[model samples]
Target chain A: MPSDVSAPVSNGKPGRLRRLIAARAEGEALRKGNLLVLAVLLLVAVVALLPFYWMLSSSLRMPDQMFANPVQWIPNPINWASYPEAWGAQNFGRYFFNSSVVAVLITLGNLLFCSLAAYSLTKFRFRGRHLSFMLILSTMMLPLEITMVPLFLIVNSFGWTNSYQGLVVPFLVEGFGVFLMRQYMLSIPTDVIEAARIDGASELRIFWMIVMPLCKPALVALAIFTFREAWDLYIWPLVIITDDALRTLPLGISLFMSGYGTAWDQVMAIAVLGTLPMALLFFFLQRAFIQGIAGTGLK
Target chain B: MSPVSSSRSARPGPASSGPKTPGRRPWLTPGSKQTAFAWAILLPALLILAIFRFLPMLEAFYLSFTDYDLISPPRWVGLQNFIDLTQDPLFLKSVQVSLIYVSCSVIPVIPLSLGLAILFNRALLARNFLRSAIFMPVVMPAVVMAVVWTFMYQQDGVMNTILGWVGIDPVPWLRSSSTALWSVIMIGIWRAVPYYMVIFLAGLQAIPRDYYDAAKIDGAGSWATFRYITLPLLKPTMLLVVVMNVIVAMKVFAVPMIMTGGGPGDATRVLPLFIYQTAFEFFDMGKASAMSVVMFAILMAFAFIQVRLFTRKEEQ
Candidate 1:
């Protein structure tokens, strides 16, 4: 992992030897400082992860043992039934299917449309191009609150209330996705497209056969982001859809608390369940999530 | 959300013309017939934005001036909702509470994230694990966090249980009107800091090691190097993090809603929840639209100023 792997003293003459000792002293001090930083960082990490740990620990405990006075980190007897019971009681299978469908649809929609828009913008010569782009950017400034009334009206007019189309279609075209794809495509060498053009490849053919193949990383990043956003969306879904069967994971988890009036065990169980898919996604492809964030250049 | 500034994506390709044509390929000019393909690609997003985003904005602005209940047709009563907002004590308090929430969440996040990121950057062991752990909360749904946090802050909850070990009396967290807002603020911080830290970590990585090495060669101490070199370069990132944090904090709703329902007595009510209550719970769409317009204005002002500042800095 070292950027330059040569030893402190590649040439060990007398003066070089003395300088090496001095450099070693500096290295020692730097390591010492880094150790202090590492200790503090580990402390913060523990604090940051404490809730997850507690949630996991509590989830495995007997229901009655959850709030036992002088709470023990390790309960006397572990209980695993809470997982299955909570899953059964909360209609989690249905919620999971709903979340999965929404997330997947949104991801697919974003990947397809965003790349097409990106391709056209990067590869075509069109009028008012900048204005169209500016219009897209301008939408980012409008708070969702301002759009709520009209959106609600339009959805109602379409009779899309309590329907998946209402939830998914409006979000299929994301400005951010278009923006990210454009930025990435800007970096793609124009020669490839010209070569494809010389071969008489159509625009759609070039996009699919050439650009899309090269945009895998950006597409993966966009997919992860769209999935997470769709999975966690709360307010709009809450406002538009009222049917008990139509709630997303977030709404479903919250409903568990409100309906049963906050049974600590049940809430914890559901929270853990709700967090599982995304958490596993993070665990396995943390690289993709980090890449997604960095690729967006927002960080 | 701001308008989709997708300039990079929608930039027109260079004109295609023979040398003889000499800038006369009018078809190839941007925003003309030739670029219809690009516009076609952008069409779906543009259509959705028009219908779902922009149309509602205009409608909301129109509604804010009237006295419309959802059941009854909106009646034109110009500025009544605004007047009602001005006179409404709860609305005033909500505005104040929202400001407090934004200020509290935004102010502390930068320094906290910087400190955390610097530590993580310097750490040699368990670096990846620690980073993932810190960033875990960022992806956790806010509703889940609220549910779990509400449990932890209960009178006999885990937090008070820990407090008991320190001989501190049990403190009502979300239940007490006075403490509820602050409690929500803590959750906001806890939930928010990790995201900012991830950003700061990326910024930290971008800082070239040669600068630190040069500072070291000059016999500069750790603090001097950090103050003189690190802080200055990180300023741009710090500004970005603060602006984004404030924007996210301003939209905070699910956290407070699930945790306290805006209170023991409206103590925790902020604008979004307030808007929800006004529009849905009370069925007063007009008054709700007024609050929405106010929120839209505040956010727009913030975004405009922020984008200007960001672009200005970039230009410099």
Candidate 2:
């Protein structure tokens, strides 16, 4: 087929004319295919974003006019009061504070500790090295349901229930973070570490100075992922946090829905606020966010 | 709960070339110093994992067999909790419900996502814009998704209104037990498709373009190219998507918990929700642990298959 097309049908003018027409037809088909792909993707994107768009639009939907019959696609008279009303309706301010503090602390802990552990694993050779690596790897697959009981008991033993320690400590350094940092750290050459060591830099110093900086991209990815995971904490917090004041954003939103009963506008407003931090993180670290999943070759 | 980070199996590598100066620093570090260094750096992570992670993971197995109610010392009752679960209709029903939910949501996702990926793989106009728009839900916390969907699925809400446009009746999305599980499952698919699409898109992008060029020159149609070149190459990625999605789907708790609280009846009460209620609401820790162990066994079987698949591929 290729020979026939490229040989230019060297015999005649009719053949050359046919080839030009065929090429033009192919271009038209290519254009047609492009349009089809574009149309399908666009349609799917609209459907995918519809709920988010609804959350935003409905949040802005006028509180009194929220019940208008035909489904207000756009809030005809835009309302910003729901944002303030929703914020005041519950302990959302407190929820926001708790979520931020916990997410930040967890992210910082993961960035520091996971890197240390990964660096140790990648740069050093020791007895039972493979065992420890596999052990950490195994924990990554253990769902919270499997371990929640004993973990709850352990947290309760320390009198940490309803406290920040219970929410913050168990998730401080996750297995995903450890594995991510380790994979990236493996590509960091050992020569840099050896030189730093020969110069009498402490192991901690080398990790802090040489290893940490080299692992910057991975650290950013880990930080974004850790913060996202921490922000998404619901079941664990719901189980442990009995006090309403200690509720995170997820709990607060659920509580607000139940407490306010039918305040649809306010409920949507809180949903928007609940999702804001993650949206902001996506805006800034979209590359790291996508790369963390794609580069790691898992979803 | 499935770890998606760098799920590639750890494999041995070729020996590294020796240092240019062989006498310099003993090629990385000496043996004894390396062990001390490893211990020093590894202690904090190891200690934390040992206390909170490893212990709890192992204890999950033991806790399943004992009768504990959070009030007193757990008494040994080997296989009693598991046996009771077999007798409990709700637990048995939940297992059935979960299997149906996983199959319904996960099976449809592969083709839907792969289709999306194939479209986005082309250099169509506004490709990134379209890709990001679809992917936005994956970033939204599951809590927000549940709430938003709960609102949308109201009797007189946007969903029903849309259905009315097409002359369809307002189905009780969350009000009826029959549609309640499917309502949550729809949301599950909504959130899941984009995530798996991203995975599939990455897989598509990694394939060499030369394969397509060769197929095109051979007069192979688009479907033939996809069937031969794309599908075969996407096997590993497809396995990851299927296994991870199954594991994640089996653990679907937040959506069902928030949306229906297990249902108008026992319709949406999945395994995790059942476990939560048994442990916390009913204060039957032993029963909940037993259920989790059962869920764990199911997930482990999927995981084992994944390992076998990958190892087989590597051998090939």
Candidate 3:
């Protein structure tokens, strides 16, 4: 009736009205389809985050209630005692310090050394330049897992075991970092470097002042990547650090878990503490982090 | 490849800019100076790599052939370690375990990650927040992931509790030999799916929007559009994800090491974890190095494919 009231009596009126109904149906279907997609994505996101939520909830629950029937999704009288107990139980303060020192040094070293190598590889023409680049790229196959035996022998020979140098030195400059920096620097215009060169600016001056400033995004990406890898280092430190005082966070947590397997609250607490720094870093630098990964893959 | 190589060759000659009197300052040629500066900048990194990466690689190869136990000097026994490995049941079992882990984990990762990527690629509300939430697993430290997962996989843990709500009997996740490796495999998929999803999302975004519009005009359905348009354009990204997923899966260590410690039997003893135990716990460096050489070969095959893929892309 409404259609009859609104419709004009013309030859094309029925056909136009039919098209209008079809388009409306299609639009409604599309809207429903979008809602379905959103729901699916939200479910996946929840599934992905469930472990983290469990970690937090377990950390806050009392020891007796950890295995309660129906599963305490939320702790009623929240136990905040686990944090200090876990931290003090294994001298975690020292472990955090060790992790911080090692991660910072490794990050700085990669940013400086990888950028320098990348700059030379990209912007400069010299003999054996391609050879060097190829050789560096080939190192991708030689992950620490395959090389740890000889590396341990080499480190022990240097008497570097149980020292920061053992953990930090071997990982200072990664092949992946060099590759990432090279890929990013390839997009930097050659004229800019040449113009600075023509002005009689020293190479170091040009690198420090002109080139490095233009590479902020790549640098940030490299820094975060190196820092995360260094912070999460487990195998190398497990092999090298026998001294409890020198153990990094991963080593300390593993040892703590083994020693106090029954203390679920404390174990979860250490897990949360160990994960906090990286979570915070990612939270703040989410855009750069995602873009960095996407850039590497797309490139 | 041709463009990059040609650009390298076309760099301006330093001879074009020199003092009028060439013989007076032969050592000060701009070309030589540039070379020197480049080498100076590259020296520190090259030195570090030479010491840490190159030397150890060579040492690993050499040590595989020689019997060494930190106390005694290495004694060369040609092919003996390799021969022993052939007869070693644990080593063989570990290889099987690693193969199973790699195939099972890597296979699911490809489709699941791509599916997630495709879903996220759609325009929707709170997309960014949802993406960030899914990405949280990636930023969790591997050690913490191992610890938290070990907690969750316990008999009375949350994982079993949730299954009960769905009217399913609780399963022994990491306890029995039958399910231990599978449990570790599940964790591997959980962590890796999010990472490779990001990579796949990048690949999806790289696809030109015009293709979809054209497909729609041709009356193509959703499945057909994905099959013809999306699949063909996503070939390179698919290769990258497969290679990277296999590599990560092969190198999985921290989880099994912390969770099962190679298990109640040899259920979850992946190659790397077995190699560690052989070298450190068992003090058989020669055999361990031989195992490393084997891993190196497997990884190199994948790495070779990756390099070819990259070079081919460059040529295009």
- The parts of candidate 3 lying over 4 Å away from their true place are A1-26, B1-30, B303-316
Residue by residue across A1-299, what tens digits does model 3's lDDT show?
00110111111444445534544667878678778988888898888999999999899999999999978899978999999999889989999999999999999999999999988877776677777887887776678899999999999999999999999999988888898788667656666777787899998998999889888877877887788778989999999999999999999999999999889999999999999998898889887776655655644
Docking class of 3: acceptable
Ranking of candidates on TM-score, top first: 3, 2, 1
Whichever of 1 and 2 has more DockQ, that candidate is 1
lDDT tens string, model 1, A121-211? 6556556656666677677666565566667877889999999999888888777788777756665666677677678886668778988
The backbone clash count of each candidate, in order, is: 26, 0, 0
lDDT of 3 by residue, B97-191 (tens): 99899889988998999998888775456777888899888899999999999999999988899899899898899999998999999988999
**Span of ten consecutive residues with least summed lDDT in model 2 chain B:** B1-10
Which residue pairs clash in candidate 2?
Answer: none
Candidate 1 residues B175-269, lDDT tens each?
89988999999988987788777767666666666788799889998799998899878777777676667767888888888888899899999
Q: How well is candidate 3 docked (DockQ)?
A: 0.32
Q: In candidate 3, residue B103 scores what lDDT?
A: 88
Model 2 lDDT at residue B308:
91
CA lDDT of B301 in candidate 3? 78
